[model samples]
Target: MAEVMADNRVAGAKGDGRFEPIEDSQARMLADLYERHYEPIFRYCVHRLFDRTLAEDVVGAVFLDAARTIRNFRGSEEDEYRRWLYAIATNHIATHIRTSLRRRVLLQQAAEAGRLGPHDEPARTDGPEWPQVWRAIQTLGRNEQTILTLRFFENLDFASISAIVGKRETAVRTMLCRSLKKLRTQLKSVFDGDR
Candidate 1:
Protein backbone atom coordinates (compact mmCIF):
# COMPACT_ATOMS: atom_id res chain seq x y z
CA MET A 1 0.00 0.00 0.00
CA ALA A 2 1.01 3.64 -0.39
CA GLU A 3 1.15 4.16 3.35
CA VAL A 4 3.50 1.21 3.83
CA MET A 5 5.68 2.38 1.01
CA ALA A 6 5.80 5.91 2.42
CA ASP A 7 7.26 4.54 5.64
CA ASN A 8 10.27 3.14 3.75
CA ARG A 9 9.84 -0.15 5.59
CA VAL A 10 9.47 -2.64 2.77
CA ALA A 11 12.57 -4.78 2.69
CA GLY A 12 11.95 -6.19 -0.74
CA ALA A 13 9.42 -7.85 -3.03
CA LYS A 14 8.62 -11.53 -2.98
CA GLY A 15 9.27 -13.75 -6.01
CA ASP A 16 5.55 -13.48 -6.70
CA GLY A 17 6.06 -9.70 -7.23
CA ARG A 18 4.05 -8.84 -4.14
CA PHE A 19 5.57 -6.58 -1.52
CA GLU A 20 6.39 -8.05 1.84
CA PRO A 21 4.25 -7.08 4.78
CA ILE A 22 5.33 -3.95 6.65
CA GLU A 23 5.74 -6.03 9.78
CA ASP A 24 8.29 -8.18 7.97
CA SER A 25 10.61 -5.26 7.34
CA GLN A 26 13.21 -4.48 9.99
CA ALA A 27 12.57 -0.75 10.35
CA ARG A 28 8.80 -0.94 10.10
CA MET A 29 8.68 -3.97 12.32
CA LEU A 30 10.48 -2.07 15.04
CA ALA A 31 8.05 0.80 14.60
CA ASP A 32 5.08 -1.50 15.04
CA LEU A 33 6.79 -3.23 17.95
CA TYR A 34 7.56 0.10 19.63
CA GLU A 35 3.90 1.03 19.52
CA ARG A 36 2.84 -2.30 21.00
CA HIS A 37 5.52 -2.75 23.66
CA TYR A 38 6.73 0.68 24.76
CA GLU A 39 4.22 1.12 27.57
CA PRO A 40 4.88 -2.30 29.08
CA ILE A 41 8.60 -1.74 28.82
CA PHE A 42 8.26 1.63 30.51
CA ARG A 43 6.16 0.06 33.25
CA TYR A 44 8.83 -2.60 33.77
CA CYS A 45 11.54 0.05 33.97
CA VAL A 46 9.49 2.11 36.41
CA HIS A 47 9.13 -0.85 38.72
CA ARG A 48 12.74 -1.79 38.25
CA LEU A 49 14.17 1.66 38.90
CA PHE A 50 11.45 3.12 41.14
CA ASP A 51 12.00 6.46 39.47
CA ARG A 52 9.53 7.76 36.92
CA THR A 53 11.71 10.31 35.11
CA LEU A 54 14.71 7.97 35.05
CA ALA A 55 12.50 5.16 33.83
CA GLU A 56 11.22 7.32 30.99
CA ASP A 57 14.79 8.18 30.03
CA VAL A 58 15.70 4.49 30.10
CA VAL A 59 12.72 3.58 27.91
CA GLY A 60 13.74 6.16 25.35
CA ALA A 61 17.26 4.84 25.41
CA VAL A 62 16.04 1.27 24.98
CA PHE A 63 13.98 2.10 21.89
CA LEU A 64 16.78 4.22 20.49
CA ASP A 65 19.17 1.32 20.90
CA ALA A 66 16.64 -0.97 19.27
CA ALA A 67 16.30 1.42 16.36
CA ARG A 68 20.03 1.58 15.88
CA THR A 69 20.51 -2.19 16.07
CA ILE A 70 17.36 -3.40 14.32
CA ARG A 71 19.18 -4.31 11.13
CA ASN A 72 21.18 -6.89 13.04
CA PHE A 73 18.14 -8.31 14.81
CA ARG A 74 17.35 -11.85 13.73
CA GLY A 75 14.14 -12.41 15.64
CA SER A 76 11.54 -13.95 13.36
CA GLU A 77 8.61 -13.87 15.78
CA GLU A 78 6.90 -11.18 17.84
CA ASP A 79 7.70 -12.94 21.10
CA GLU A 80 11.34 -13.18 20.15
CA TYR A 81 11.43 -9.47 19.56
CA ARG A 82 9.81 -8.90 22.92
CA ARG A 83 12.47 -11.02 24.58
CA TRP A 84 15.19 -9.16 22.75
CA LEU A 85 13.85 -5.80 23.84
CA TYR A 86 13.65 -6.91 27.44
CA ALA A 87 17.16 -8.29 27.27
CA ILE A 88 18.37 -4.93 26.05
CA ALA A 89 16.48 -3.17 28.82
CA THR A 90 17.84 -5.53 31.45
CA ASN A 91 21.39 -4.96 30.31
CA HIS A 92 20.92 -1.21 30.31
CA ILE A 93 19.55 -1.27 33.84
CA ALA A 94 22.48 -3.38 34.99
CA THR A 95 24.92 -0.96 33.46
CA HIS A 96 23.14 1.94 35.07
CA ILE A 97 23.34 0.26 38.46
CA ARG A 98 27.01 -0.50 38.04
CA THR A 99 27.82 3.19 38.13
CA SER A 100 27.53 3.52 41.88
CA LEU A 101 28.29 7.23 42.13
CA ARG A 102 25.92 8.25 39.40
CA ARG A 103 23.19 6.01 40.74
CA ARG A 104 23.61 7.40 44.24
CA VAL A 105 23.50 10.97 42.92
CA LEU A 106 20.32 10.25 40.98
CA LEU A 107 18.69 8.58 43.97
CA GLN A 108 19.61 11.54 46.11
CA GLN A 109 18.07 13.94 43.66
CA ALA A 110 14.91 11.85 43.47
CA ALA A 111 14.65 11.69 47.24
CA GLU A 112 15.13 15.43 47.59
CA ALA A 113 12.41 15.96 44.98
CA GLY A 114 10.11 13.63 46.92
CA ARG A 115 10.00 11.22 43.97
CA LEU A 116 11.71 8.22 45.56
CA GLY A 117 10.20 5.13 47.20
CA PRO A 118 7.29 2.90 46.13
CA HIS A 119 5.09 4.58 48.73
CA ASP A 120 5.24 7.83 46.77
CA GLU A 121 2.51 6.43 44.54
CA PRO A 122 -0.06 3.71 44.94
CA ALA A 123 0.90 0.92 42.56
CA ARG A 124 -2.30 -1.09 42.73
CA THR A 125 -5.79 -0.99 44.18
CA ASP A 126 -6.02 -4.73 44.38
CA GLY A 127 -3.86 -5.24 47.44
CA PRO A 128 -1.79 -3.53 50.15
CA GLU A 129 0.96 -6.06 49.66
CA TRP A 130 2.25 -4.24 46.58
CA PRO A 131 4.65 -1.97 48.43
CA GLN A 132 5.85 -4.78 50.66
CA VAL A 133 6.50 -6.99 47.68
CA TRP A 134 8.39 -4.21 45.92
CA ARG A 135 10.59 -3.81 48.96
CA ALA A 136 11.31 -7.51 49.01
CA ILE A 137 12.13 -7.53 45.32
CA GLN A 138 14.52 -4.61 45.76
CA THR A 139 16.53 -6.64 48.22
CA LEU A 140 17.28 -9.30 45.62
CA GLY A 141 20.39 -9.55 43.44
CA ARG A 142 20.32 -8.26 39.88
CA ASN A 143 19.56 -11.59 38.21
CA GLU A 144 17.06 -12.61 40.85
CA GLN A 145 15.33 -9.27 40.59
CA THR A 146 15.18 -9.50 36.82
CA ILE A 147 13.94 -13.09 36.91
CA LEU A 148 11.19 -12.24 39.39
CA THR A 149 10.17 -9.14 37.46
CA LEU A 150 9.93 -11.02 34.15
CA ARG A 151 8.22 -14.06 35.63
CA PHE A 152 5.63 -12.48 37.95
CA PHE A 153 5.29 -8.93 36.66
CA GLU A 154 5.60 -9.57 32.93
CA ASN A 155 4.12 -13.08 33.18
CA LEU A 156 6.69 -14.47 30.75
CA ASP A 157 7.19 -18.22 30.41
CA PHE A 158 10.46 -19.98 31.14
CA ALA A 159 11.39 -20.31 27.46
CA SER A 160 11.02 -16.58 26.81
CA ILE A 161 12.79 -15.79 30.06
CA SER A 162 15.62 -18.09 29.09
CA ALA A 163 16.06 -16.16 25.86
CA ILE A 164 15.99 -12.81 27.63
CA VAL A 165 18.39 -13.86 30.37
CA GLY A 166 20.68 -15.89 28.09
CA LYS A 167 20.23 -19.07 30.09
CA ARG A 168 18.89 -22.54 29.39
CA GLU A 169 15.16 -22.91 29.90
CA THR A 170 15.70 -25.43 32.65
CA ALA A 171 18.08 -23.07 34.41
CA VAL A 172 15.56 -20.27 34.18
CA ARG A 173 12.89 -22.49 35.73
CA THR A 174 15.19 -23.59 38.53
CA MET A 175 16.30 -20.01 39.22
CA LEU A 176 12.69 -18.84 39.31
CA CYS A 177 11.79 -21.51 41.86
CA ARG A 178 14.73 -20.55 44.03
CA SER A 179 13.95 -16.84 43.71
CA LEU A 180 10.35 -17.44 44.75
CA LYS A 181 11.44 -19.47 47.72
CA LYS A 182 13.83 -16.74 48.81
CA LEU A 183 11.18 -14.05 48.36
CA ARG A 184 8.79 -16.10 50.50
CA THR A 185 11.34 -16.47 53.25
CA GLN A 186 12.23 -12.78 53.08
CA LEU A 187 8.59 -11.75 53.35
CA LYS A 188 7.46 -14.44 55.77
CA SER A 189 7.54 -12.21 58.81
CA VAL A 190 5.30 -9.57 57.27
CA PHE A 191 2.86 -12.20 55.95
CA ASP A 192 2.76 -14.03 59.24
CA GLY A 193 2.18 -10.82 61.14
CA ASP A 194 -0.67 -9.94 58.79
CA ARG A 195 -2.36 -13.28 59.40
Candidate 2:
Protein backbone atom coordinates (compact mmCIF):
# COMPACT_ATOMS: atom_id res chain seq x y z
CA MET A 1 0.00 0.00 0.00
CA ALA A 2 1.04 3.64 -0.47
CA GLU A 3 0.86 4.21 3.26
CA VAL A 4 3.16 1.30 3.97
CA MET A 5 5.62 2.48 1.33
CA ALA A 6 5.36 6.03 2.56
CA ASP A 7 6.36 4.75 5.99
CA ASN A 8 10.06 3.96 5.95
CA ARG A 9 9.70 1.32 8.65
CA VAL A 10 8.38 -1.52 6.52
CA ALA A 11 11.95 -2.92 6.34
CA GLY A 12 11.44 -4.75 3.04
CA ALA A 13 9.00 -6.60 0.84
CA LYS A 14 8.41 -10.35 1.03
CA GLY A 15 8.97 -12.54 -2.02
CA ASP A 16 5.22 -12.23 -2.61
CA GLY A 17 5.71 -8.42 -2.74
CA ARG A 18 3.66 -7.70 0.41
CA PHE A 19 5.12 -5.58 3.10
CA GLU A 20 6.14 -7.55 6.19
CA PRO A 21 3.10 -7.74 8.42
CA ILE A 22 5.32 -7.99 11.49
CA GLU A 23 6.45 -4.43 11.00
CA ASP A 24 2.88 -3.22 10.79
CA SER A 25 1.95 -5.19 13.90
CA GLN A 26 5.03 -3.89 15.64
CA ALA A 27 4.04 -0.33 14.91
CA ARG A 28 0.57 -0.92 16.25
CA MET A 29 1.96 -2.74 19.24
CA LEU A 30 4.33 0.12 19.95
CA ALA A 31 1.40 2.50 20.03
CA ASP A 32 -0.25 0.34 22.61
CA LEU A 33 2.98 -0.18 24.47
CA TYR A 34 3.43 3.56 24.77
CA GLU A 35 0.01 3.94 26.31
CA ARG A 36 0.59 1.17 28.85
CA HIS A 37 4.30 1.35 29.59
CA TYR A 38 5.17 5.03 29.34
CA GLU A 39 4.35 5.98 32.89
CA PRO A 40 6.24 3.12 34.53
CA ILE A 41 9.23 3.68 32.29
CA PHE A 42 9.19 7.37 33.12
CA ARG A 43 9.11 6.55 36.83
CA TYR A 44 12.00 4.17 36.41
CA CYS A 45 14.02 6.88 34.71
CA VAL A 46 13.08 9.47 37.30
CA HIS A 47 14.06 7.27 40.22
CA ARG A 48 17.33 6.31 38.60
CA LEU A 49 18.31 9.73 37.28
CA PHE A 50 16.95 11.73 40.25
CA ASP A 51 15.82 14.54 37.93
CA ARG A 52 12.44 14.81 36.31
CA THR A 53 13.76 16.71 33.30
CA LEU A 54 16.62 14.30 32.74
CA ALA A 55 14.30 11.34 33.21
CA GLU A 56 11.93 12.82 30.64
CA ASP A 57 14.75 13.09 28.15
CA VAL A 58 15.88 9.53 28.81
CA VAL A 59 12.34 8.14 28.56
CA GLY A 60 11.83 9.89 25.25
CA ALA A 61 15.09 8.40 24.01
CA VAL A 62 13.94 4.92 25.06
CA PHE A 63 10.70 5.14 23.11
CA LEU A 64 12.45 6.71 20.16
CA ASP A 65 14.83 3.79 20.21
CA ALA A 66 11.90 1.41 20.29
CA ALA A 67 10.32 3.10 17.30
CA ARG A 68 13.57 3.30 15.40
CA THR A 69 14.26 -0.40 15.77
CA ILE A 70 10.73 -1.75 15.83
CA ARG A 71 11.06 -3.38 12.44
CA ASN A 72 14.04 -5.35 13.54
CA PHE A 73 12.40 -6.55 16.76
CA ARG A 74 11.47 -10.18 16.48
CA GLY A 75 9.47 -10.60 19.65
CA SER A 76 5.84 -11.56 19.19
CA GLU A 77 4.88 -11.58 22.87
CA GLU A 78 4.16 -8.65 25.13
CA ASP A 79 6.55 -9.84 27.85
CA GLU A 80 9.33 -9.96 25.31
CA TYR A 81 8.50 -6.43 24.28
CA ARG A 82 8.48 -5.27 27.89
CA ARG A 83 11.87 -6.86 28.53
CA TRP A 84 13.15 -5.22 25.34
CA LEU A 85 11.92 -1.85 26.50
CA TYR A 86 13.57 -2.25 29.92
CA ALA A 87 16.80 -3.31 28.23
CA ILE A 88 16.65 -0.16 26.15
CA ALA A 89 15.97 1.90 29.26
CA THR A 90 18.90 0.25 31.04
CA ASN A 91 21.29 1.12 28.24
CA HIS A 92 20.01 4.67 27.93
CA ILE A 93 20.28 5.28 31.66
CA ALA A 94 23.81 3.92 31.76
CA THR A 95 24.80 6.00 28.75
CA HIS A 96 23.24 9.11 30.21
CA ILE A 97 24.93 8.58 33.55
CA ARG A 98 28.28 7.99 31.89
CA THR A 99 28.09 11.00 29.57
CA SER A 100 26.59 13.46 32.07
CA LEU A 101 28.45 14.10 35.27
CA ARG A 102 25.53 16.25 36.37
CA ARG A 103 23.17 13.28 36.51
CA ARG A 104 25.69 11.11 38.34
CA VAL A 105 26.26 13.83 40.92
CA LEU A 106 22.56 14.20 41.37
CA LEU A 107 22.14 10.46 41.95
CA GLN A 108 25.01 10.47 44.41
CA GLN A 109 23.49 13.39 46.26
CA ALA A 110 20.13 11.69 46.38
CA ALA A 111 21.67 8.53 47.79
CA GLU A 112 23.51 10.57 50.36
CA ALA A 113 20.23 12.19 51.37
CA GLY A 114 18.67 8.73 51.80
CA ARG A 115 16.29 9.08 48.88
CA LEU A 116 17.72 5.80 47.64
CA GLY A 117 16.95 3.97 50.86
CA PRO A 118 13.84 2.05 51.76
CA HIS A 119 10.88 4.39 51.94
CA ASP A 120 9.47 2.69 55.01
CA GLU A 121 12.49 3.70 57.10
CA PRO A 122 14.09 7.09 57.54
CA ALA A 123 17.82 7.50 56.93
CA ARG A 124 20.13 7.62 59.93
CA THR A 125 21.62 11.07 59.79
CA ASP A 126 23.62 10.38 62.94
CA GLY A 127 26.08 8.37 60.88
CA PRO A 128 28.71 9.64 58.51
CA GLU A 129 27.77 10.69 54.99
CA TRP A 130 27.32 7.90 52.43
CA PRO A 131 29.38 9.52 49.70
CA GLN A 132 32.29 7.18 50.36
CA VAL A 133 30.11 4.12 49.94
CA TRP A 134 28.57 5.56 46.82
CA ARG A 135 32.02 6.35 45.49
CA ALA A 136 32.82 2.70 45.94
CA ILE A 137 29.67 1.90 44.00
CA GLN A 138 30.90 4.17 41.25
CA THR A 139 34.14 2.30 41.15
CA LEU A 140 32.24 -0.83 40.16
CA GLY A 141 31.99 -1.83 36.55
CA ARG A 142 28.97 -0.67 34.58
CA ASN A 143 27.40 -4.11 34.58
CA GLU A 144 27.79 -4.33 38.36
CA GLN A 145 26.20 -0.95 38.86
CA THR A 146 23.37 -1.90 36.51
CA ILE A 147 22.71 -5.14 38.33
CA LEU A 148 22.68 -3.42 41.69
CA THR A 149 20.38 -0.67 40.47
CA LEU A 150 17.96 -3.05 38.82
CA ARG A 151 17.79 -5.22 41.92
CA PHE A 152 17.79 -2.71 44.78
CA PHE A 153 16.52 0.49 43.21
CA GLU A 154 14.06 -0.90 40.72
CA ASN A 155 13.05 -3.87 42.94
CA LEU A 156 13.31 -6.29 40.04
CA ASP A 157 13.79 -9.99 40.70
CA PHE A 158 16.62 -12.06 39.30
CA ALA A 159 14.40 -13.59 36.64
CA SER A 160 13.19 -10.24 35.37
CA ILE A 161 16.70 -8.83 35.59
CA SER A 162 18.10 -11.80 33.68
CA ALA A 163 15.54 -11.26 30.94
CA ILE A 164 16.27 -7.57 30.76
CA VAL A 165 20.03 -7.96 30.86
CA GLY A 166 20.07 -11.09 28.66
CA LYS A 167 21.90 -13.08 31.33
CA ARG A 168 21.06 -16.40 32.84
CA GLU A 169 19.11 -16.19 36.10
CA THR A 170 21.98 -17.80 38.01
CA ALA A 171 24.38 -15.31 36.51
CA VAL A 172 22.14 -12.47 37.57
CA ARG A 173 22.00 -13.82 41.10
CA THR A 174 25.75 -14.29 41.26
CA MET A 175 26.39 -10.82 39.95
CA LEU A 176 23.94 -9.33 42.43
CA CYS A 177 25.47 -11.23 45.33
CA ARG A 178 28.97 -10.21 44.37
CA SER A 179 27.99 -6.59 43.95
CA LEU A 180 26.23 -6.59 47.30
CA LYS A 181 29.21 -8.11 49.06
CA LYS A 182 31.42 -5.44 47.62
CA LEU A 183 29.02 -2.75 48.78
CA ARG A 184 28.87 -4.31 52.22
CA THR A 185 32.62 -4.20 52.48
CA GLN A 186 32.53 -0.54 51.51
CA LEU A 187 29.78 0.05 54.03
CA LYS A 188 31.89 -1.54 56.75
CA SER A 189 34.68 0.89 56.03
CA VAL A 190 32.29 3.82 55.99
CA PHE A 191 30.69 2.81 59.28
CA ASP A 192 33.68 1.54 61.17
CA GLY A 193 31.81 0.54 64.34
CA ASP A 194 29.06 -1.29 62.47
CA ARG A 195 29.26 -4.82 61.10
Candidate 3:
Protein backbone atom coordinates (compact mmCIF):
# COMPACT_ATOMS: atom_id res chain seq x y z
CA MET A 1 0.00 0.00 0.00
CA ALA A 2 2.78 2.40 0.84
CA GLU A 3 4.47 1.68 -2.45
CA VAL A 4 1.25 2.50 -4.25
CA MET A 5 1.55 6.03 -2.97
CA ALA A 6 4.58 8.42 -2.96
CA ASP A 7 5.53 8.45 -6.64
CA ASN A 8 4.85 12.14 -6.99
CA ARG A 9 5.79 14.70 -4.39
CA VAL A 10 6.86 18.37 -4.16
CA ALA A 11 6.80 20.97 -7.02
CA GLY A 12 9.37 20.79 -9.88
CA ALA A 13 10.49 17.26 -8.93
CA LYS A 14 8.48 15.88 -11.84
CA GLY A 15 10.61 17.68 -14.43
CA ASP A 16 13.74 16.21 -12.91
CA GLY A 17 11.84 12.95 -12.64
CA ARG A 18 13.19 12.25 -9.22
CA PHE A 19 11.15 9.92 -7.03
CA GLU A 20 9.93 11.35 -3.77
CA PRO A 21 8.27 9.55 -0.90
CA ILE A 22 4.60 10.14 -0.32
CA GLU A 23 3.52 12.59 2.31
CA ASP A 24 0.45 12.17 4.51
CA SER A 25 -1.71 14.15 2.07
CA GLN A 26 -0.95 11.90 -0.85
CA ALA A 27 -1.64 8.84 1.29
CA ARG A 28 -4.98 10.30 2.26
CA MET A 29 -5.79 10.98 -1.38
CA LEU A 30 -5.05 7.41 -2.33
CA ALA A 31 -7.28 6.21 0.48
CA ASP A 32 -10.02 8.53 -0.71
CA LEU A 33 -9.76 7.22 -4.27
CA TYR A 34 -10.08 3.64 -3.09
CA GLU A 35 -12.93 4.46 -0.77
CA ARG A 36 -14.79 6.34 -3.47
CA HIS A 37 -14.47 3.80 -6.27
CA TYR A 38 -14.10 0.42 -4.59
CA GLU A 39 -17.75 -0.52 -4.20
CA PRO A 40 -18.81 0.37 -7.72
CA ILE A 41 -15.86 -1.49 -9.19
CA PHE A 42 -16.66 -4.51 -7.05
CA ARG A 43 -20.28 -4.36 -8.09
CA TYR A 44 -19.25 -4.29 -11.73
CA CYS A 45 -17.17 -7.39 -11.20
CA VAL A 46 -19.98 -9.15 -9.37
CA HIS A 47 -22.48 -8.28 -12.07
CA ARG A 48 -20.18 -9.41 -14.86
CA LEU A 49 -18.89 -12.59 -13.24
CA PHE A 50 -22.11 -13.48 -11.39
CA ASP A 51 -20.07 -14.69 -8.44
CA ARG A 52 -19.35 -12.62 -5.37
CA THR A 53 -16.42 -14.74 -4.35
CA LEU A 54 -14.88 -14.48 -7.76
CA ALA A 55 -15.82 -10.83 -7.89
CA GLU A 56 -13.96 -10.15 -4.69
CA ASP A 57 -10.86 -11.75 -6.13
CA VAL A 58 -11.18 -9.76 -9.31
CA VAL A 59 -11.73 -6.54 -7.35
CA GLY A 60 -8.60 -7.12 -5.38
CA ALA A 61 -6.62 -7.62 -8.55
CA VAL A 62 -8.11 -4.51 -10.15
CA PHE A 63 -7.30 -2.27 -7.20
CA LEU A 64 -3.84 -3.69 -6.91
CA ASP A 65 -3.16 -2.94 -10.54
CA ALA A 66 -4.67 0.51 -10.11
CA ALA A 67 -2.51 1.21 -7.11
CA ARG A 68 0.62 0.22 -8.90
CA THR A 69 -0.20 2.41 -11.86
CA ILE A 70 -1.98 5.29 -10.13
CA ARG A 71 1.17 7.42 -10.03
CA ASN A 72 1.33 7.30 -13.80
CA PHE A 73 -2.43 7.80 -14.13
CA ARG A 74 -3.11 11.04 -15.97
CA GLY A 75 -6.61 11.53 -14.68
CA SER A 76 -6.66 14.16 -11.94
CA GLU A 77 -10.35 13.86 -11.10
CA GLU A 78 -12.67 11.08 -10.04
CA ASP A 79 -14.62 10.63 -13.27
CA GLU A 80 -11.60 9.90 -15.43
CA TYR A 81 -10.07 7.77 -12.71
CA ARG A 82 -13.31 5.88 -12.40
CA ARG A 83 -13.39 5.21 -16.12
CA TRP A 84 -9.84 3.93 -16.03
CA LEU A 85 -10.71 1.64 -13.16
CA TYR A 86 -13.68 0.30 -15.09
CA ALA A 87 -11.41 -0.40 -18.04
CA ILE A 88 -9.09 -2.36 -15.79
CA ALA A 89 -11.97 -4.25 -14.22
CA THR A 90 -13.31 -5.00 -17.66
CA ASN A 91 -10.02 -6.52 -18.77
CA HIS A 92 -9.64 -8.51 -15.56
CA ILE A 93 -13.14 -9.97 -15.74
CA ALA A 94 -12.76 -10.78 -19.41
CA THR A 95 -9.47 -12.53 -18.69
CA HIS A 96 -10.96 -14.43 -15.79
CA ILE A 97 -13.92 -15.48 -17.85
CA ARG A 98 -11.83 -16.45 -20.82
CA THR A 99 -9.18 -18.44 -19.02
CA SER A 100 -10.93 -20.09 -16.11
CA LEU A 101 -14.72 -19.81 -16.15
CA ARG A 102 -15.98 -20.21 -19.70
CA ARG A 103 -16.26 -23.95 -19.57
CA ARG A 104 -17.57 -23.84 -16.02
CA VAL A 105 -20.26 -21.34 -16.95
CA LEU A 106 -21.36 -23.46 -19.86
CA LEU A 107 -21.43 -26.60 -17.75
CA GLN A 108 -23.29 -24.88 -14.95
CA GLN A 109 -25.85 -23.51 -17.38
CA ALA A 110 -26.34 -26.92 -18.88
CA ALA A 111 -26.70 -28.55 -15.48
CA GLU A 112 -29.19 -25.96 -14.34
CA ALA A 113 -31.24 -26.35 -17.47
CA GLY A 114 -31.23 -30.10 -17.30
CA ARG A 115 -32.17 -30.12 -13.64
CA LEU A 116 -34.86 -27.44 -13.86
CA GLY A 117 -36.57 -28.70 -17.00
CA PRO A 118 -38.23 -26.47 -19.59
CA HIS A 119 -40.74 -24.67 -17.35
CA ASP A 120 -38.72 -22.99 -14.60
CA GLU A 121 -37.43 -19.46 -15.15
CA PRO A 122 -35.27 -19.40 -12.07
CA ALA A 123 -35.62 -20.26 -8.44
CA ARG A 124 -33.91 -17.05 -7.31
CA THR A 125 -33.18 -14.27 -9.73
CA ASP A 126 -31.60 -11.98 -7.16
CA GLY A 127 -28.54 -14.08 -6.51
CA PRO A 128 -25.87 -15.23 -8.95
CA GLU A 129 -28.01 -18.11 -10.14
CA TRP A 130 -30.47 -16.39 -12.44
CA PRO A 131 -30.45 -19.56 -14.45
CA GLN A 132 -32.30 -18.61 -17.62
CA VAL A 133 -31.22 -15.00 -17.90
CA TRP A 134 -27.61 -15.67 -17.01
CA ARG A 135 -27.50 -18.50 -19.49
CA ALA A 136 -28.68 -16.19 -22.20
CA ILE A 137 -26.16 -13.54 -21.16
CA GLN A 138 -23.39 -16.12 -21.31
CA THR A 139 -24.17 -16.65 -24.95
CA LEU A 140 -23.22 -13.09 -25.86
CA GLY A 141 -19.74 -11.92 -26.84
CA ARG A 142 -17.56 -10.25 -24.22
CA ASN A 143 -18.20 -6.72 -25.48
CA GLU A 144 -21.96 -7.22 -25.46
CA GLN A 145 -21.84 -8.52 -21.93
CA THR A 146 -19.75 -5.54 -20.85
CA ILE A 147 -22.14 -3.14 -22.54
CA LEU A 148 -25.15 -4.69 -20.86
CA THR A 149 -23.50 -4.76 -17.46
CA LEU A 150 -22.38 -1.14 -17.75
CA ARG A 151 -25.70 0.08 -19.20
CA PHE A 152 -28.32 -1.76 -17.15
CA PHE A 153 -26.68 -3.31 -14.12
CA GLU A 154 -24.30 -0.43 -13.53
CA ASN A 155 -26.70 2.22 -14.89
CA LEU A 156 -24.01 4.02 -16.85
CA ASP A 157 -24.70 6.21 -19.87
CA PHE A 158 -23.84 5.14 -23.39
CA ALA A 159 -21.13 7.76 -23.74
CA SER A 160 -19.42 6.53 -20.61
CA ILE A 161 -19.60 2.95 -21.85
CA SER A 162 -18.24 4.01 -25.19
CA ALA A 163 -15.26 5.58 -23.48
CA ILE A 164 -14.58 2.49 -21.45
CA VAL A 165 -15.05 0.16 -24.39
CA GLY A 166 -13.19 2.37 -26.86
CA LYS A 167 -16.20 2.80 -29.14
CA ARG A 168 -18.34 5.70 -30.19
CA GLU A 169 -21.54 6.54 -28.33
CA THR A 170 -23.65 5.48 -31.30
CA ALA A 171 -21.85 2.18 -31.51
CA VAL A 172 -22.41 1.57 -27.83
CA ARG A 173 -26.10 2.31 -28.18
CA THR A 174 -26.42 0.13 -31.26
CA MET A 175 -24.61 -2.76 -29.61
CA LEU A 176 -26.76 -2.50 -26.53
CA CYS A 177 -29.97 -2.64 -28.52
CA ARG A 178 -28.79 -5.63 -30.46
CA SER A 179 -27.64 -7.38 -27.30
CA LEU A 180 -30.97 -6.80 -25.54
CA LYS A 181 -32.85 -8.03 -28.57
CA LYS A 182 -30.74 -11.14 -28.66
CA LEU A 183 -31.29 -11.76 -24.97
CA ARG A 184 -35.04 -11.28 -25.37
CA THR A 185 -35.15 -13.71 -28.25
CA GLN A 186 -33.13 -16.28 -26.30
CA LEU A 187 -35.25 -15.95 -23.18
CA LYS A 188 -38.57 -15.87 -25.02
CA SER A 189 -39.05 -19.58 -24.59
CA VAL A 190 -38.31 -19.43 -20.89
CA PHE A 191 -40.77 -16.60 -20.33
CA ASP A 192 -43.54 -17.85 -22.60
CA GLY A 193 -42.98 -21.58 -22.58
CA ASP A 194 -46.45 -22.41 -21.37
CA ARG A 195 -48.25 -19.78 -23.36
Clashing pairs in 1: none
Candidate whose TM-score is highest: 3
Better of 1 and 2 by TM-score: 1
Considering summed lDDT, which 10 consecutive residues are worst modelled in model 1? 1-10
Please give, for residues 12-95, the per-residue lDDT of candidate 3 as tens digits. 344457755546565576689799989999989877776677889999999899888877888887678888999999999989
| lDDT of candidate 2 over 79-174, digit per residue (tens) | 788888989999998889879987687767776665664456666656654444556677667778777877876777787889898889998888
Off by over 4 Å in 3: 1-24, 110-129, 189-195
Please report, in order, the local distance difference test score of every candidate based on alpha carbons: 0.78, 0.77, 0.78
**Where is model 2 poorest over a 10-residue stretch in terms of lDDT?**
1-10
Q: Roughly what TM-score does model 3 have, to 2 decimal places? A: 0.76
Model 1: per-residue Cα lDDT over 35-151, one tens digit each: 999998998887777667878988999999999998888878888889999999998888776765577456645544544456666544444355456666766778888988998
Candidate with the larger TM-score of 2 and 3: 3
Listed in order, each prediction's TM-score against the native is 0.74, 0.66, 0.76
